[model samples]
Target: MRPPDNRRRRFEELYQANHDPVLGYVVRRTANGHDAADILAETFMTAWRRLDDVPAGEKARPWLFGVARRALANHHRGERRHTALTARLASELSAIQRQPREESADMDALAKAFEDLSDGYREVLSLADWEGMSIAEIAVVLGCSANAVRIRLHRARRRLARALSVDPPGRAARARVPEGDSA
Candidate 1:
């Protein structure tokens, strides 16, 4: 058997290798950086606890993603409230300062479009567009048939396109509109 220190070192190696992908997975599913961090921490915690169950080699990414999905679900369950995932994502994009102003504006508009999407549409878009998961993989993540994921993705894309086409509020309009106009 490997020494305890050797096993611990191996686990750290596996974790470090998978960290970025796992973080991306959490960020795509959650609304904000805070939630993403929470989910990521929970995912790694699960991994540490179930290290023996994680398969060796290339299959690790999928296994870790599965853990992330469970952690997100648990978060939602415990909170008993669901924030719009796209809204959270929008806030995250706004927090990134390195991008040019024009690029940030575009991202803000895209985030609004995403937020306007129906929950089904947002979920499909998050899985496919944000997470870069294949339709088959999204189907697995969502527990739906592949055809279902495809149909939802198609509709969601169309809706997002429509949402993006709408003009954003001007400064005057933003100031004048009642607080509940979009809400």
Candidate 2:
């Protein structure tokens, strides 16, 4: 294995090689150069910290893109959080009906069903389905054994299916998802 110094040099080389492309990637996705620059700096900093996790040679670009993608997602989530806070403050300051939009009844039911899931089930499902993370990646993120992730994912799906009435309640109860396995 190479020395840590050697690894640092390699990471520096990667930064030199990919910085422009990474910046371009962020710039195209972001609204302004300032946000792009922030994302660019964050992406490289993450790469620097996780140098060993970065794939070698041809795969590095895509890996860096993935990192940037996560950063962008986090950025958007923060924006949404701020927006939600403002909305909440506005709601507190006034009297509004806050009527639900004209969503389909089925959509409402699905949303309720998803909301009814336990936090653990919801998280695993979101990470797997919404975030498009692989089982191994989910395992890494959740800090659990891969088999445990698979088991929880399986259980979460079954519970969600039951909630949505896609799976029979009898089976959902009978299978009995182990409470011990949580992300």
Candidate 3:
């Protein structure tokens, strides 16, 4: 079915008069022919929807161009949103891929050495390193003086350092592995 003849004719007249100028306006401001065509179509659709708002004669050209300009701006905003989403997704994916590789043999050896520490050394070290507790805070947790917690923390670090020196983290796993061999 067709629109009433008058409405169809009015739309055709409007399109015929303003289409080339609107196309040129969109094309000059757009990145490519495809985007220009899309914006141009949207401009005409807006004009068709708001035919009563469109002016006559010389004013009509500027009015159509304004619609085209707004259409181009909407296209650019959508593109920016898409680009931002893509960048965010790529960063999240890279973080996920990099996490497992960080859980390597060095950390395993360090864990074993940490577990072998005596209870007192483990308590102080775990508070200071793992739990990120300050000496005063560790003292509160362990019911001791801050000065005592500090001394215990120092001795705990020394013991862990000596253990690591004897069986250095990553040394046994990485040593003698041939280049380009994953095993």
Estimate the TM-score of every prediction: 0.42, 0.47, 0.53
- Residue-wise C-alpha lDDT for candidate 2, range 1-183, written one tens digit per residue: 655798889988999999999888898888889888989989999998899899999899999999999999998888899999999879964533344444455667777988999999899999999889999999999999999999999888888887877873356456555799754
Evaluate candidate 3 by giving its C-alpha RMSD to the native, one decimal. Answer: 20.0
Model 2 has an lDDT value of: 0.86
Q: Which of candidates 1 and 2 reaches a greater TM-score?
A: 2
lDDT of 3: 0.85
Worst window of 10 by summed lDDT in candidate 1: 166-175
Top-lDDT structure, candidate number = 2
How many residue pairs clash (N, CA or C atoms closer than 3 angstroms) in each of the candidate models, in the order given?
Answer: 1, 0, 0
lDDT of 1 by residue, 75-182 (tens): 877665445666676787567767889988988998888988888889899988779999999999999999999888877877777688743334235645578696
User: How far does residue 147 in candidate 3 sit from its true spot (Å)?
Assistant: 61
Q: Indicate the TM-score of model 2.
A: 0.47
The TM-score-based order of candidates, best leading, equals 3, 2, 1
Candidate 2: list runs displaced more than 4 Å: 1-3, 94-183
Superposed by TM-score, candidate 1 places the C-alpha of residue 140 at a distance from the truth, in angstroms, of 38
